[model samples]
Target: MTRLRSAAAALALSAAAVLPIAAPAHAESRAEAQVNAFFGQYRDAVLGQNPNQDPTDVREEFMTSELNTELDQWAADHDADPVFRAQNVPSGWSVAYGGSGAGHSTVILTEYWAGGGHTDVWYQVRLDTLRIDGLEDAPQ
Candidate 1:
């Protein structure tokens, strides 16, 4: 009887430990969903009107102030327009928790260019603000 109780207790403890791990997976899915929704809004705002238009000319009020400033500075410094061209590809988004807050996540997006080149875009998405605060070129 004692051995049976010990085995049951061990099983209960293991089950409790596994339950927390499952919760984070659900949280991560929610974060990825938020990123996808933001991208959908961006696609509508930039590409819905004119598919061939230069996206750099579109106003970026949808972005976080810091991200917008950094992108604008990059364009001004390089004397070239920076645009995020949309591509129809399979889901390749990956999200990591940023450790700052519950809604802070780092999202990796694989975006394709007009010339068939592909690049991964990294963004620090703060779901609280529903915007990306930082954007950087993903390392190869």
Candidate 2:
């Protein structure tokens, strides 16, 4: 009888422990959703527009958001105009991939040249961990 009680008690304890693990702390928050939405909007803006100034221009690219003006200015400074030309390929895409990590919505993206020729990558950025200026560090 004593053995039976002990076994049942252990089983109950184990079951209690297991149940909490089944559920996460909570659902993803509104902040996470908002951050992901922002990333999606930026990505769409990049992909939807023509990267080249002229259709005939062999190569061109542009990323005009204040969020990342440094890189845009850098491209302009160099001989390489932000342009890529191909029949059907996107000249450049602000490819943003979002995931939840460290209790935050994180993003990693690249300014990619079509056909995988070249890319300028950004590290992961976490939501709820941004500065006052709305910039988040890219997670390693």
Candidate 3:
């Protein structure tokens, strides 16, 4: 019984040691969380998981009017979905806080495609309103 208790304690200690290091990896900043939530809903809409919701409506809710207009033009120009920046929806995605300055914050969204490959979309968010104001391909 004593040996079992010692082994259990060792396991517990190991878990405890890993908890702090693992926690931050899962931690989402405010900007990241917002972007993540938006993407999740947008993806659902695009996939028709939410029958009542439209993907364009989702974009309007999260993005600035000017950005929405720009996205529309971009979609026409590229002949692809402007938000995904691709013709197909991604299989997975992640959002991260890039940086903030001049009353705006940057959010980096990496989209994982089916089969293989990924795309990074950079979003500019207004700090005060937290509204996404710009979306563009990752800078060269």
Candidate 4:
């Protein structure tokens, strides 16, 4: 969970290039919070030997179902992280969160670990709204 937060901070935020965005008036919205919590629980589920159980993909692009094999192949070919996990833990307020340009109102965090490799993930939020946008490598 801590790592997920860290990843969120890292992707949606940086020292220099992060343009300012408005913050939510009441912390994370109920919808956003629910999505965060939901994903947080599910992403962790893949870390074990649990076989493919979901009908979603790392991008929630459709990892399960009849397309499962295809999505898995794509992840491999693209070096995409399939088990990355993330959540929205609240980050105070902002003025640029009007959900303006870039479809930046959603956020997704994903964590991936393979053998002794370091876990990896990419967090993304709204460049305009300052909320989670899309987890780069998350399962739906």
Best candidate according to lDDT: 3
By lDDT, the better pick of 3 and 4 is 3
Q: lDDT tens digits, residues 100-120, model 3?
A: 899988999999998999999
Candidate 1 TM-score over all chains jointly: 0.51
Decreasing lDDT order of the candidates? 3, 1, 2, 4
At residue 120, what lDDT does model 4 achieve? 26
Candidate lDDT values, in order: 0.58, 0.42, 0.91, 0.41
- Per-candidate Cα RMSD to the true structure, in Å, reads 7.3, 9.7, 4.4, 17.1
lDDT of 1 by residue, 58-138 (tens): 335446666677877876776643334233432233344433466677776666555466666676767676566766777
| Better candidate number, 2 or 3, judged by lDDT | 3
Q: Encode model 2's per-residue lDDT on 1-140: one tens digit a residue.
A: 99999999999999988886555554544544443444444444445553433322211121224434543455466644222212233344453445556654443434445556544334333354441112333435
Candidate 2 differs from the real structure by a C-alpha RMSD in angstroms, to one decimal, of: 9.7
**In model 1, where do residues sit more than 4 Å from their true spots?**
1-28, 48-61, 79-103
* Residues forming the 10-long window of minimal summed lDDT in candidate 2: 55-64
lDDT of 4 by residue, 1-140 (tens): 99999988888668436676667666754434534554454454445322554425333431223334544565687675333322222111111222333554443332233332332233344444333333344233
The full ranking of all candidates by TM-score, starting with the best, is: 3, 1, 2, 4
Positional deviation of 89 in candidate 4, in angstroms?
18
TM-score-superior candidate, 2 or 4: 2
Residue 27 in candidate 3, Cα distance off native in Å: 3.1
